[model samples]
Target: MSSLISIVLPVFAVIGLGWLAQRRGWLGDGGAGALNAFVFRIALPPLLFLAMARTPFEAFGQWRFLAAYLSGTAGVWVLVWWLAPRLGFNGFQARWLTCLGATFSNAIYLGIPLFETAFGALSAQPVILIALMMNLLLVGGSLIVLQAVSGEGTRAAIKETLSNPMLFAIGAGLLVSWFDIALGDGADRLLSLLAQAASPVALFALGVTLGVAGSGVRFGRPQWVLLVAKLFVHPALVALACWGFQADAINAQAAILIAAVPAGSLVHVVAARRGTLETESAALILLTTAVSVVTLTLLLEWLL
Candidate 1:
């Protein structure tokens, strides 16, 4: 129980600090993108690589863990997709945003910090694997759903995913890990510095993004559907998956934490870019994030 508090409070503190910074105009508006870009491009890559390098691949080599996690995510995605239409979100709009909200998570920003706090240094492996998995889902799953929802050019979305800096970084990190190449002493030190910077910068950026999202106009069927999918259905499905897989304590805890995260704040950006429910997407990201502090804390205590 104390571990749950230990994990969640610091994260909400950072987020609250960022929100306070934005509220005070200490950080400029819309700077979240810049902060997100920095983490995604620079800070996160090294973090991922270093985390993976140290983790024994043999430990994570279990297909059951991978399948369990992926299936949990997929089950939520489908539930959201089905429910959105039932809630009166028809056509591509419902499909795309439902898919986005159901699958995407604020894993890198909130997930890493929270897990590290709860589990110790070894948390990095699960966090890294989860981050990598989410990134792949974001690029591939997000694009495909968006394309289907918006009826946009599939070729263009594919290109954008391929060109995404985060995806490229994850790939590089995995490659470095697989090949057994170390960053060495000097380079390792530098990369470690950058990796350490990821959480703070990303959280601050999240604040700026939230500020922007807060100002946006929202609410309607779309918002309702998205909120339920992200806040309720996703976590429920993840819990079931964890039980079904008979995951160990650590894996089960990790899965629950990952499941409890809100929709990625950047889902709004994706929606805006693709011409979907921009306001609602942004709003849900902000709303779910706020609610998640309580939701995650409770779930963690229960799962742990």
Candidate 2:
């Protein structure tokens, strides 16, 4: 329990500091945007690059881990989308937003930091793998779903996915790792410095974003669904899948923890870009993030 607190509290505290900074007007109106730009362009790409560069192809043999994670995550996505209409969440955008809120984990901004804190930076193999998996499957698939239903062209989605710097970094890192290309000590150290900044800055930017957009939205049916689905149903399914797949202990625990993270920023991004349920999406992201502290802490105590 104490260990879990040690991991969970400090991360949330930094996020809270950012929220406070935003609320107190310490951050300018564009502060969150600027910080996010830096994190995405400067910090995260190097972090992912380094992580993939170090990850051996042998680690990719954990098909069981991917099997479990995919089953759980995709299961949540399908279930939420199917149930949304029945629950009176009408329209493609609304249902998609609800499904996204339920299934998308904040793997980048929050998951990396928490996993690094709990399991150490060397364990970032699974962390990065899981993050990459989530982004590709969930976010990528969301666009396809939107295209099929809402008449949005999948061409844009394909372009965006192909052009993403993080994915490019991951691919480059994999080639380097696989072929054993050695970047010298200086380049490695430079990347390491940038990588170190990804977590805190990303978390701070997330908090600032929440401070900017998470308010003025009253709790509604969507929020209620997000509350239960994100915090409970999704994680529970992932844990069950882990057991079912007989995943190795370490990967099983990591997979479960990854599933337990909050609604990701991409949910809001999708909603905002498409002019959908922005307020509710923001509320879902904020609500799930706040509640995951308790939920994940309990989960870690049990898993440990």
Best by TM-score: 2
Q: Candidate 1 at residue 82, lDDT?
A: 76
Tens-place lDDT digits, model 1, residues 1-304: 7767777887787887777777777756556667777888889777777776666656667555556778878887777777777766677665766677667888878878777776775576775677667766764667776676556667876776677665666567667767777677998899889988987777767766777677756666666666667767777777788788887667767766787788887677777766777776777787788888888888778765
Overall lDDT per candidate, in order of appearance: 0.73, 0.85
Residue 93 deviation, candidate 2, in Å?
A: 2.8
Off by over 4 Å in 1: 1-3, 148-152, 217-226
**Which candidate number maximizes lDDT?**
2
Clashes of each: 0, 0
Q: Write the per-residue lDDT of candidate 2 for residues 1-304, one digit (tens) a residue.
A: 7878988999999899888989998977789889989998899999999888888767768878778988998888888989898877788778877788898899899988888888888777776788887787778777767876777678888787767788888888988888988999999999999999999999998888888877787777768776788878888898899889999888888888888989898888888877888888888888888988899899878877
TM-scores for every predicted model: 0.88, 0.95
lDDT of 1: 0.73
